[model samples]
Target: MKDWDYGELFEAINESYEEFLANGRGEKFAVARAFNEYANMGKIEDIITGVAIGEILASHDKVFIGYIEGITGWLSEVGKKDLKNELSDGEIENLLGRIATVIRDLRNKPIDSNPVA
Candidate 1:
């Protein structure tokens, strides 16, 4: 993965929605484009920030997904299940850092094998 600037990622996500809202295209088209951008993140590369942005979007009701579930689902998946609530920039960075570290550690863990006794 490329070195990520989570701060930049957060700004980009906010900018994207704001831009979409102001776009000359109709709201439907703008939303479609936004969603396309979300889907394209995986196509271009499995950038953690991209996925993170998507999850952030998912936490909001403005996108037609659902009411705000916060990021609990994501946190739980990464094994930090207890974390919940609105967050400041620094808190978000710390959470993302922990998630990234856990992901890295899991990726690097050796596969285990057992012989039949």
Candidate 2:
């Protein structure tokens, strides 16, 4: 086994995303015919929770929740409430971009100094 590589990981995740769109649901209904199975188990939550924040973060959810509350307060200051509802596909793009940037920065920095702030 060699050292881990994130470029490969990113490619794998993108492939999963492509698969998500291929056989995706478009059900028939009198009132609605829309994309289904796109919001449930194939969600980005598990990826974010497990990798971006690390599994150890689950034990620090309270601390992270408080941090998120602080972020919500900042959003409110910018006239945005219910941020989750406001977020669109753009949010996913932003998260992916940030992940790539953070990974790049981390690779360039020394481990003992904690590049992940």
Candidate 3:
């Protein structure tokens, strides 16, 4: 499996989010396309893609909530069997919620930039 670049992953998501905001909601969500691209890259890529999606959900507006079912359906269409199974079991939302919780908690914590000498 190729080593996925986190920068690229986040960049794709950010660009997609910007597009979603610029265009009306009627515009197809580019983030799902990004997820589709990454999900096919490898077995583990879906997990990373899920994390990216969760991060977006964590920091961004609630607009994405309305698209969860669509995203879940898209993933079911293209994701691996294990992912499909998880989606079928209706656990993707739970997983995303957990990931978002972790992201939200991390974001809430302050970073200490200065190191003790």
* Candidate with best TM-score: 3
How many pairs collide in each candidate, listed in order?
A: 0, 0, 0
* Candidate 2 to native Cα RMSD, angstroms: 18.8
lDDT of 1 by residue, 61-108 (tens): 343222112223343354223323334556556766755653443334
lDDT of 2 by residue, 23-53 (tens): 5531111001111221132234323322332
User: Candidate 1 at residue 105, lDDT?
Assistant: 39
**Best of the candidates, lDDT:** 3
lDDT, candidate 3, at 86: 30
Clashing pairs in 3: none
TM-score of candidate 1 relative to the true fold: 0.38
What is the clash tally of candidate 2?
A: 0
Candidate 3: tens digits of C-alpha lDDT, residues 10-112: 5676676666656655323545554555566665455556666645544433434334543444333443444454342444454445455545543454442
**Each model's TM-score?**
0.38, 0.27, 0.42
How many Å off is the CA of 8 in candidate 1? 0.7
